[model samples]
Target chain A: GAGVSQSPSNKVTEKGKDVELRCDPISGHTALYWYRQSLGQGLEFLIYFQGNSAPDKSGLPSDRFSAERTGGSVSTLTIQRTQQEDSAVYLCASSPGLGPITQYFGPGTRLTVL
Target chain B: GESVGLHLPTLSVQEGDNSIINCAYSNSASDYFIWYKQESGKGPQFIIDIRSNMDKRQGQRVTVLLNKTVKHLSLQIAATQPGDSAVYFCAENLHSGGGADGLTFGKGTHLIIQP
Candidate 1:
């Protein structure tokens, strides 16, 4: 079975620039989540989507961060006016919404704000 | 500060030895706990999980223990191997009203194996 996938394995951008990261969840997965990991830090919850009903944007660090999941399959996280402190690895994970709480993750996109 | 945080970021142990990784989580409302292993340049893989109701649960060679009194969770790997060398993360699902609530993770502990 195909696992979750993310694009732009690595990204380098200047401060104040905007970047969009993509995530492709496994087939039939109804749950998708986005997280951020900074150096020597833990995974910070960003947003989550379940069957496209008003994604949970509670974890977004600031107003500049936003995400959208379409057709309950793919998700994109957009960081507007990125800051140097926003440099970190962005992780995406997905799981089935029925029984267990196990989440399959994707190789994150490392964003470097210079 | 009551958040998930690791006491040690790096731990080195010899092969065949038992490994213990510790984590402290705040928010006593966290009833669900999970352990994830992340290798270099890869996403996290689920290792094991335990609910707050149970104090201990075992899976294969890994065991997860939860102490609600102290708000502590630990993962013990029996007969550790080189393949087990990676970063271990402890995450908690804060029981909220929203569907598909997010998980709060602790700073990961990087496990190193000595041959």
Candidate 2:
């Protein structure tokens, strides 16, 4: 079966620029999540979406970060006015709707804010 | 305030030897734990998982041990191979009232296989 997929394997942008990273979850997956990983660090949760209710933005580092999942399938994470600290790999994952289910991850988009 | 952490940043084991990676978690409310492997340029792949009720679980050549009393978790790989070289992470999740939250991941341990 096809796994989760993300676009722009690598991205380089200037500080204060905005970037949009896309994610396509596996078919039939209802729960989607976005995470960030800095070099030599752990995965940091960003946001989560479950069948279109309000997304969980608790983990978003700041108000400049936002995400949207449309039609319960694809998701896009947008970082506005990116800062040097936002440089990291952005990863996307999806699961079968919750409760101890394993999440499938995408290759991720490496964002570099110069 | 709650976080998951690993004791070692790197581990080197000879091929055909066994490898053990340890993790510590601070959230007692976490009921599910998972291990993942991430190779360079790739996202994390799920390795194994165990619930709080179970102390141990086994996969093909891997075993996951959870000690809730000590908030410790370990992943043991038997006969480690070159392909096993990667960053291994331990994650904990709290299931609340049928809603699922994102996992909290440890800093990760880099496993190097020596031939």
- The parts of candidate 2 lying over 4 Å away from their true place are B97-100
Question: How big is the positional error of residue A41 in model 2, measured in Å on the Cα after superposition?
Answer: 0.2
Candidate 2 chain A: 10-residue stretch with minimal lDDT? A51-60
Predictions in order: lDDT: 0.88, 0.92
Residues A4-82 of candidate 2 have per-residue lDDT tens digits of 9999999999999999999999999998888899999999978778877534567889999988888999899999999
Residue-wise C-alpha lDDT for candidate 2, range B1-115, written one tens digit per residue: 5489999999999999999999999989898999999999999999999998999999999999999899999999999999999999999988664443788899899999999
lDDT of 1: 0.88
In candidate 2 chain B, where is summed lDDT lowest over 10 consecutive residues? B93-102
Candidate 2 RMSD computed on C-alpha atoms after optimal superposition onto the true structure? 1.3
Q: Taking the candidates one at a time, how many backbone clashes does each contain?
A: 0, 0
Per-prediction DockQ scores? 0.58, 0.64
Tens-digit lDDT track of model 1 for B1-70: 4389888989999999999999999888887899999998888898998888899999999999999999
TM-score of each: 0.93, 0.97
